[model samples]
Target: MSLPDIKEALNEYEFKWKAEQVTIQATLLKEHSDGRVTGDITITTQAKEYHPHIHQSQFNFSAGRTRETLAKTLHSRVPDLISLKQWEDIIEQLCVKIVAMIREGEPALELAIDDTKNIPPEYLLEPILLKGLPTIIYGEKGANKSTLSILFSICMLLPWKDNPLGLVCPTRSIKSLILDWEQDKEIVQYQAKCLKDGMNLPYFDVYYRHCARPLANDLPQIARNISKVGAEVIIIDSLGAACGGELNKPGPALDFFAALRELRIASIILAQTSKDTESKKKTVFGSTYFTYYARSVFELVKADEIDKTSSDIALFNREANYSARHDPIGFHLTYNGTGIMVQRQDVNIGQFIKRHSTQQAIYEVLKRGAMKPKEIAKETGENENAVRVALSRMKAAGKIVMTDQGYGLLSKDIMQ
Candidate 1:
């Protein structure tokens, strides 16, 4: 055989032979300047069939030693050195050895009782995202999911005195990376300018990549980039575009998230709600695996009382595994000449609309004139019982009064 072939054969034999014994190994450490090979030929087996006192013997070859000479030297000293066959067989045997070793011992299941308390979750956005876990934000088209995600990224990147979302963050400023598959260069440039100007920060630490590759193919490269930049947070805009495979299938979904887990960076994945009304779930647009693997899930929807054209949005904490679900938060999206801007609005809007719907209906009807509960209910299209309950609450609040006819706004409070 040629010198290169002989060297390959010797290397293959070393690896395969080591696996059969408990502590036997042959390693080529280095080549000396004068053409001598220096390495260890160790034998740990206590078997009497092998030579005694050959525990960890070092072999230093003289200058100009050929591969055949090295192989002969190794074969003479090491007992039962296997010969290399086809490359496929070598690979197959290596795989088998690995599996056998892995299955050789059972793992311990007990935990140490003396260990300290478990670490509390570190929040990038408290109650919404934990530092080491994955978070997903889902909404229908035009629900501002991407805008909200961008806003969150900016908040994490900026050194704000107060929490931008009115939520808690463990750190004031975080290095963030946004892998946007949806937006173009112009849009992202505009967004960066907006965040920088709006926050009045001279500089921001967030990084952006307008990604075109699928998660499966690009995860390794993405991970290297993140590590190179030392990013603490990453956002994958619109999970569908990044997945590159049928998300409804379990294999691809699991694979995508598995890749994310391996990345070890806190992630925020944007997703869409199913266009088909009949197929829509409380979770995201695709397979349930998206929600199953996510640490937290949030949903964005159009505000009920707010007009769609008004650019109002409501954010709901659909799922939060680490903490209790938070109340719905509201936001107003508007372009501030740089990019789409997210302004936090009243968080109590959802609750207020639900709790005061009947009362507001009654108040509007009573503005015309005093009317009985049945008449008010008819005019407002609310249940009579609901109208009565609302009237009682409204009267107690001094916003309305019980008159001889029915109910009317308190004079002092009216026309104000």
Candidate 2:
């Protein structure tokens, strides 16, 4: 009815639909008729021309129907004839047409979350963000640790159905520079093959650096190179290859870590935990600084008797100066037709309990002696409600006893 309304309708229609028979060269132009703006749409093909009179309200609807019908019939033939981007454009235009009809009936526009200032760089990052930090994948020998690292690299570069880690979404495009000192050329080729097949994404600038010592002299140079390429993430395959300088001292490692932060890039440094029985520490290698320096650590462990390997993903809180908890989130690895695939496995309750202080305190209280609900709450320094909840769970697990004297932990399961 109005000029603005008609213009809006046409624009919406353009967005919602595409020409069904593109064999018909289509031209849409506006004209004024009896104080009302109308559209004279011309459809010209190989042979004849068809002129269609489209009103403001009906323009979008008709366009959508035409597009839908044509798309269904020409689906198989369109890809062979047009480029992917062109096909995308055609589909997008059709969507616009369908959306135009509904726009008028819809309520006034609502404000959306302003993320223009929030978009990260378009480069891909490997070892995708989990728990707000980059993670290093480490495991025992023969565990396919590198394979897992490659899988992570692929996950970050590819578009997954949901966010793998419960971190922020609509992440900035990331650029990762992988320094694979281990240098298994075959595996690298396999990844490239996966990328070609679209099984994995090759959006990042991938580089293969083969050297005995990736950390000596090469570390800073590598950082500069990735900076030039605008990479936001870097993956150093193994700590052994990447650690040539004095690791015990903070000076060397500190500079390397600082360079990464300066470039606004996160690093995933994979390292192996030594097998010697003399070592008491649980982390990969080095002193507290290794774990201390890293923002997050994911330890991959192999089942002693079982054929499968498990990965425990841990979130390290820098401010707190320790992992909020140490129990690793578990995953099972298997080889699919293409390559190694990882599926999240079961939760480890023992690890889970040790990591949680409240749960530990409750268990401790029940272990010492039997006490009433109120007594147990006081002894555990927990609230009545919390104590009751813990008691219920412990009882369900058969870890605690409901005695006439009070609540007692089953001694057999006390240490467990």
Candidate 3:
């Protein structure tokens, strides 16, 4: 029979030919930095009443190297080990096919998003993570971004509908994998256990993989694990360590995302802000390309230190590609001794920008009653001047009207 069919899995090609106990396989078909097409090959043999043997090694996609690697790999003496000549011939055939395949490059599909069809954007996690795209949640140290992700992951893994997190999930459960570079499995394990217990879940079994290398360098193994665990959603535990290169450089940033895209699954990547972010405006602590490449980004801000049980947090949409920037959503995570509860709270916990826009926050509060600028400022924790400026802008934009009472929206149903 002819050589086995080559199948593309992400950025690699996998090929295998088998007949009963005699089998041969090839995988990881991709190029190296020096422009050589290389991959791993394996040969396995077992025969009736004879010993079974296996041999595996890296193979270069060239006739000369294939011939050398194949010659001594199998011989007539070992039952089912094809004759030397036959082995060489099979590898040679594989080399020729792979060389041609590599030169031709990954197949491309024609692009079309015709307006007539009008396909809407899809989400793996509504309003938080997009389906089959990359989204980020970045914050300073101790902000509990990772823990927040774990809470979301449980919602998706069990995929609880109408869950308390207020995040929507598909009817079907999606498996999740966490690739941790910042923390080891033990820490993650403890965190997972606590969350599971706190959430009162009977079971929480999302997969976890410890990572130290750049994602691209670990694609093969990660892909294998993804397949093994049936992971559809991946949570990258922070970006700095995963980058595995100069965090400030575009090359590392681009490569890291390219690797994620190659995995071809929905991803929620956790990231850290620069050390001085609290004193300055917070941005993801990496190349600007990180921001550019991401489909959506959220800046998570924690209000204060966690004393024992509760912490207030706010999520500000820094960028969104597919939809309108969301109103700031705030949450209060209460970790009681037995369980954890995440509830929607006013984002106005501490001194930071709160929901929709400051204007929307003001309008929401104003819907209760018209309040003066100082009252609005007091309600939102915004300095009086900033609230007045927002109010003035809202008036100029025809969004708000000044009245004897204080300030009011021109339209009551701003949501409309």
Candidate 4:
């Protein structure tokens, strides 16, 4: 029997082989870690009314089990759907072509290093986001992590220069996408509109998708979507749903990180903080890989001050791979029925950092007029000994002035 030539589609993940009135399509091809090529092969007819002879089922490169299953299913379910000999020929061609496709690319190549100090790590937003790497922001639900991403997308989409947010956009303009797992398209749409209208900028598009499947399972479709829009960056609304389920397990974490690596695009991933009151430590809520694999990480915090129209938000740098972790970035947000606005501001240092560090708490108390160590302890809710120790260190560091009045800031801007 002559074998039909299988035609590879423009998308490397798809292939087709035609025989008689039926077309066999192999799609969503993936190479496993063990080097096995697996995909779905559907047998369909080119008729006015569409019906699948063998609805898509997963098949490996060898196609032995799949071929037998297809044959048995056809013979038992619907007799003589296709001749046995024709089926054998299609399976043989399919196996050969699948093997070739799986083995197409070189595993490794010669190193190409043209110069020393040639290229520095590129940044989409300096100190916050590295270009083409994942950045994580995890916090309590109402901390506005998702809102921050939306604003970042706007900054890049509008190509804001001397941006009010204090983060520089290195490129002229960036194309971005949003994959929302926790929210619907309508919510994101309204948020985008309110933000843009508040800034008084003309409307523009930022590609968006509402996602449900695990990123690893849905990479091909996501890749196609990214390619279609020429998106340079992606914002995954939250991490818990993106890993599918059982996010605490190592497998999902590994798979999620691998999927992001395969994506090869700049990303801002929002995550939830693990509820750990005992340690007073906040991790990315699920797997440690969510924090470890990410190129940069931040803990988002909203101030305790009650403001109906505004939020005092800060992104505290937790980790950075390319450089030192930075001082927290402070942004003030004001929103109402018709508009939303974000602007750079000094962190409301006292309330936001008080719980995390005794130094910060002491610093906050001393920012007002000078006070004795005993007074500082009472004001900051700390032990007198601890406050005394901190004050001694602060004086040695030239951060506080010692006077008849007691300890105080050398100047208001001393910390800066």
Ranking under TM-score, best-scoring first? 4, 3, 1, 2
> In candidate 4, residue 187 scores what lDDT?
88
TM-score of 1: 0.59
Q: Could you give candidate 2's per-residue lDDT for residues 1-416 as a string of tens digits?
A: 10111223211132222233232212232222232222222222221243232112212223445545444434444444434444445544534533444333447888788756765333233223433244555556665566556555555554343533323333544555677778776667676554334333344434555556535445445655775766556677777657656666675566445433433556677777645534323455554566666666665655433433234433222222223534334555444445444555544433333233455566655655778988876765567998788778878887677888888877785554
- Residue 266 CA error for candidate 3 (Å)? 0.6
Local distance difference test, candidate 4: 0.77
Ranked by lDDT, top first? 3, 4, 1, 2
Residue 129 Cα positional deviation in candidate 1, in Å, after optimal superposition:
1.1
Best by TM-score: 4
RMSD (CA, angstroms), candidate 3: 4.7
After superposition, candidate 4 runs with Cα above 4 Å error: 1-12, 18-38, 45-54, 60-63, 71-83, 92-106, 277-279, 358-415
lDDT-best of 1 and 3: 3
> lDDT at 78 for candidate 2?
42
Candidate 2 lDDT (Cα, whole model)?
0.50
